[model samples]
Target: MIRNDIRALDAYHVPDASGLIKLDAMENPYPLPDTLRRTLAERLANADIHRYPDAAMENLREKIAARHGLAPEQILLGNGSDEIIQMLMIAADQGACAAPAPSFVMYELIAKWIRRPFTAISLDEHFNLDADRFLQVVSREKASLAFLACPNNPTGNFWAADVVERIASDFGGLLVIDEAYAPFADRDHLHLINEHVLVLRTFSKIGWAGLRLGYAVGQASLISELNKVRLPYNINTLTQIAADVLLDHFHVFDEQATRIRCERERMQRALAAFPDLQTYPSQTNFITIRVPDAGQAFAHLLKKRILIKQLGGHALLENCLRITIGTPEQNDQVLEALKELFK
Candidate 1:
């Protein structure tokens, strides 16, 4: 029999990623160029399958540390950024309390999974963090773990950095910053890693989505505790090697990210011209737009085989749709489909 919390929990909803234009998940739609794919295939062709992965993920950790300009001791790798979130909640709650928001789904889900007392602070109408409100609730409740998504999901807007820093300082608990979308944004609190905060990042967005690699940068002491709870061999040999290879070629993806940023700006500007639609300024790779009758628009896009994230019931995001920036051609197709729908 399932635990009461497990039974009461809403099932995690993942859409059918089978065949549409597939933009719903905030994934990089560009496939690896032929040369990179061939290199990866050749590298994996000789990987030692019989042996287990390095439990410490030493090499991958080093690569991440070098890229982020931190020491290896400051980084803790995860199966994905999701696992880093779970690890932080477990470490902070220690089987007791977790606090997230109405916008982020994982913090609540994971808290429930761990059977912790979870509380949600609602966001303002613009999907911005109500810092005073959030701090007020956390202070009164004395929650030990707080999860905030910068450039928050579904809404695609970055909450102010100073506000997050204030929370971390004032709240004597673990403050987790899920920066899964940070690369696309202009501001970040990575400098806050030295402070009372833990930052999570993933290769999934940059260009290594299939590798399922994510990591947390925080104080060494905190990272060690998380390491203690993580499953041994959690990250496999192939993933470790693949991540190392990609990190070596980091500039390839950096160039791609630059192009995506350019395309995202252009897409946002173009979408703004359409009447009856309000596109939110995005710091991440995606943009969230308030459409007139989002359900009808979502369904209409589906019919045109153009998929985007529908944020119908998400607190301040009602009637909003999130669209990830794809390659130039893919973006053109999405814009064309929208024009057809609204024309």
Candidate 2:
């Protein structure tokens, strides 16, 4: 038999939206412009498949570091942020790791997988950090790690900077500011980094989901410690090329991010006009709205072939539906579907 703990847990589930207007995952719905795509294809076609990936990945690291204004030695790349989180978990194998309840679930799940005791401090009713409670619990647990998702996933709002700064200053363990949605957020925690703090960012949000590139920034000593546990060749050659090309053309991605941010605001304003649905303001690319009956609305939207996350099961998300901000026509379709359901 498998380990009892492993046997008892449900695997992370990804829904099959084979033919639906898929918006469940917080992903960029945009595609690369045709000219760029062709240019990228040419680059990939000529890459050195005969050799292994850059063992140091120095070129990609330099590009990202220069883009973010960090020293290349301060960076460590991951297949995606998940593997980076895994490395942190392995390095923090000394004690419990904590995050807010109703957070990005992987923080808890990965900690549990590694058998590190995990704590999920509950967010307040408004889904903001209960800073005092958070400080108290993590201190009590002598937590070895803390993962905070900025413009936090599922609920989608930024935790206050002052409170996070205290956690950075006071926590007994490593603190990770998971900024998977930073391209859309107003502020970042990189400036707050200390020896114990790391900031995670992913290119997935900027139309690079297929590339699976996420990197972290921290002090050289901290990053080197985390890198010790990283599997060699964790990043593939093709992915390295793709990421570098994408970073070189970051202006194009920036334009797309600008558009997504604009659309997120427009979607938020529209969600506000719904009498029956109470929507929250988000600093991320999606909005969560409370429906009178989320299950029913979720079902009706499914019938209409629109896929969004219905988060009724989590205590914090009771009657809530998380809808990713899609393209303009896609948003129009979602609005019409919701209007029909509100009828």
Identify the candidate with maximal TM-score.
2
Question: Against the hidden reference, what TM-scores do the models get?
Answer: 0.95, 0.97
lDDT of 1 by residue, 228-323 (tens): 878889898899888877777778888888888999999999999999999988988888998878899898889988888888655567788889
Model 2 scores worst on lDDT over the 10 consecutive residues at: 310-319
Residue 161 displacement (Å), model 2? 1.7
Model 1, 316: alpha-carbon shift in Å? 1.7
**Predicted model with the maximum lDDT:** 2
